[model samples]
Each structure stands twice: as structure tokens, then as C-alpha cells.
Target: MKRSKSKICSNEHAKFIKQYKSKKLTILFCQLGLLILFICLWEILTQTQVLNVLIFSSPSRIVSTISTLYTSGDLFYHIGITLSETLIGFVLGVGLGTIVAILLWWNESLRKILDPYIVVLNSLPKIALGPIIIIWFGAGMQSIIVMCVLITIVITTLSMLNAFQSVSNTKILLLQSLGASKFTILRKLILPSSLPQFVSVLKIAVGMSWVGSIMGEYLISSAGLGYLIVYGSQVFQLDLVMSSTLILCVLASVMYLFVALLEKIVHRRLGL
Candidate 1:
């Protein structure tokens, strides 16, 4: 009887996988088709000279621009600076956020006491702090990291709080009935269950961190991608602006992929 059930489960799982693959393929085809159509129209317009290349450069022009920047060494230095600031800020934010989340979960009274301060921080506009951050940290990369950290930390806390609180009452009760200690319940239950949401917050904070870093650089900086954009625009170099924008998108996407991978591993391990 057990063998029969196992075979049935295996067959059902195979069917489900096949159906899921078909749906994924359909979505991929639709997205790819739209992308190709848009690029075709863009290339045609540029080649026909119907769209002014000065304002709206061709895809080819952008590609050539990327090629030139690769040879010039300017792109690498700027990219490195921005990436360093972003990664450092992201790590600090996530590390602090997780620590705070666990601390608050361990002590509800402290969480309640700190609620007001959390609200005020969340309400504050990170962009407004750019000038102040530059004054405190100086007008360069460190200031940018500081700015990004501020933007991410509060949001991370909020996200983690929600996740930490999502542990089911029944699960806690079951563990309690099984003679589980508070520390054990927290370590094995609350923390593990919050992994998915923590991953989500990390992804969100990635974009916020990048935005804060770049905006800080924009307000005051001698290097980095945001500085590149400001300098390019001031000099009417739209190509540089577009290139920086593309690089930002890529950076955010890479960060997002890391979060996604973490989420997948956590979910699979927890059978969530």
C-alpha cells in the first residue's frame, strides 16, 4: 500500500512539473516577443532618422558608447566606487535589521518602546538627509554609503518585524506542549519562518540602497555613477546618462537575484 502511494505521488509530481514548465515557457515567449518588437521599432526609427539621435540615440549608438567606455577606464572606476558604496550599505542595513528584529522578537516590551522612534525614522525622507550626510561623512563615497544605510535600515526593520510576528500560534503552542524552551522555540520556529520575508526585505532594500547612494552622490560627490549622470547631463552627454541608468538597473537586478536565491533555498529547506 505504501509503495502504491509513493508511485502515485511521483506521477502527480511529474505531471505538475510538466504543467509548470509549459506555463513558464508561455510567459517567456510572450516577454521575448514584446522585447524583440520594441527593439525592432527603436532600431528602425533610429536608422530612418525619424527619431533624432541627439536626444534619443539608437541602440547601436548605446552599444558603441559602452564599447568606448570600456576602453577609456573611466567607466570601471566610477562603477567600482558606486558598487562599493551600495554593497557596504546593503550589508550594514541587513545585518543591523536582522539583529534588531531578533532582539525585538526576543523582547516584545522593547519593541513596543522603540515603536515611536521607528515610525519617525520611516517617515523621514532619506533624500533630505543627503546634504547633512555629506557634511558629516565628507563629500564622497563614504557619504553615499551612509545615505544608503539610512534609507535601508528603517525599511528593513519594519519588514523584519512583520515577518517575526508571523509565527503561527498553534506552532508555538505545539512546541510549548513538547517542552520546548523559549530560546529553542525562537531559534527553531520564529527565525526560520521569517526567512522568506527577510529575503523579500533584502531585495527591496537593494533598490532603496542604490537610490540613496546615487542620490547622495548626485547631491555631492566627485565620483560614482550618480556623479557620472550629473556631469554627463550638465555637459549634454545623454549617452552617459543612459549608460549609467543601464548600469544601475544591472546592479539592482544582481542584488535582486541574490535575494531570490536565498528565498528559494530557505523555502525549499523549510518546505514552505
Candidate 2:
């Protein structure tokens, strides 16, 4: 009787898992179908002259432009430059921001002193500082990276500081009462509790990092997707412009998806 009941329970659990996977697959298919439909409609409209090809630029034209770039051997070169800059900026921004946040969390006096300055910097328009940044870091990749770091760092710091502060006061106090040092409480309790928020910060930082890098490239770059966009516009090659934009969208989506995958892995590891 006991064995029969256990077998029934196991079968039900298996059925539940199968259903869950089927639902996820359906959602994935729907998303891909929607994208395909949009692309087809876009192509159809442009081919029929309903939408001006010069202005809207059909998917086929964009594909042709991409092919030209590929044949010219510039496609991967530009992509590699932009990707490397973005990854570097993303890492530096997130790492430095988190370290600053931890320091702020550790020292209340320092946090108070710097709070207003941090807020002011965050509120100030980062783009307004572009000319100065170029002058300071020159027209190279360094300036572009600095711009990316500037865009993402403040947001990461603020988000992470909030996450650290949001850990339950009661839990913190209990740990203190149990004679745990400040570092122990932070290491064992606060950091673990803030993992979800860190993931959220990563999502936000990904977009910011891309924006910063592209904007920097717009200001001063000889080779990058942003430079291609600028050059295409100058030459009135709308196809090239559209193709670069499409590539940017694809690259950004891939980066975001990577962060999402990391989030899933973290959640699973923590049983969250």
C-alpha cells in the first residue's frame, strides 16, 4: 500500500514538471513567431512601396547592407571593438560601484558625507559631460569606457546600497546579539539576502553600459557600431544605418539574455 502511494505521488510530480516545460516552450514559440511576423510585415510594406524603402529600409535591404559589411571584413571588426569596450565598462562599473556600496554600508559617517555628492552626480546629465570627458580621456577607447562607467556606476552603487540597507533590522540585531562581528553579519546575512537585488542591478547596468559605450563612440570613435551609424547618416546610406541599429539591438538582447541566464543559475543554486 505504501509503495503504491509513493509511486502515485512520483507520477503526479513528473506530470507537473512536463506541463511546466510545455508551457515554457509554447511561450518561447509565440515570442519567435511575433518577431517573424513583424519582420515579414516590414518587408512587405517596403517592397510594396507602402513604406518608403529609403526611409524605413526593408529587412532585405538591411540584410544586403550587412552582407556588404561582412564581405568587406568590417562587420566583425566593428562588433569586436564595441563588444570589448562594453564588456570592460560593464565589469569596471559594476565592480567599482559594488565596492563603493560596500564601503558606504560599512561606514555610516562616510556614507553621510558622500550621500549628497552621490545624489548630485546621479542627477546630473552624464551626456553634458561628454566634451570634458573627451578632453580628459582623449578620443580613444579610454574615453568611451569612462563614459560607460560613468553611466552605470552611480546606478549600481545606489541600487546595491539600498539592497544592503534593506536586509531585515531584526535579523541584523539578532546576529549582533549572538556576538557576530560586523563583517560576519555582512558576509553571512546581508550579502546572501541581497543576491536578488544584485541581479536586478546587473540588468539595469547592462542597458546603461551599452548606452554609455555607444554615446562615447558617437562622440569619438573611428570604428564601432556607433561610428558606423554616424558615418551611414552622413553618407545618407539609410540601409547601413538601419543595419547597424539592428545589430545593436541583437547584441544588446544577447547580453540581456546572458544576464537573465545568470539570474536563473543563481536562483537555482540558492534554491530561490
Over 169-252, each residue of candidate 2 has an lDDT whose tens digit, in order, gives: 999999999999999999999888999889989999999999998999999999999999999899888998999999999999
Clashes of each: 0, 0
Q: What is the C-alpha RMSD of each candidate to the true structure, in Å?
A: 4.8, 4.3
Expressed as tens digits, the lDDT of each residue in 1-272 for candidate 1 is: 33323333577887887787799999999999998888789879978999887777667777777788888987788889899888999999878888887888789899999999999889988887777877888877788888888888889888898887888999999999999999999888988778788888988998888888888888988888899889988988877888888888887898889888888988888788
Give me the candidate number with maximum TM-score. 2
Q: TM-scores of the models, in the given order?
A: 0.84, 0.87
Q: State which candidate has the highest lDDT.
A: 2
lDDT at 74, model 1: 79
Off by over 4 Å in 1: 1-26, 170-185
lDDT of each: 0.85, 0.94
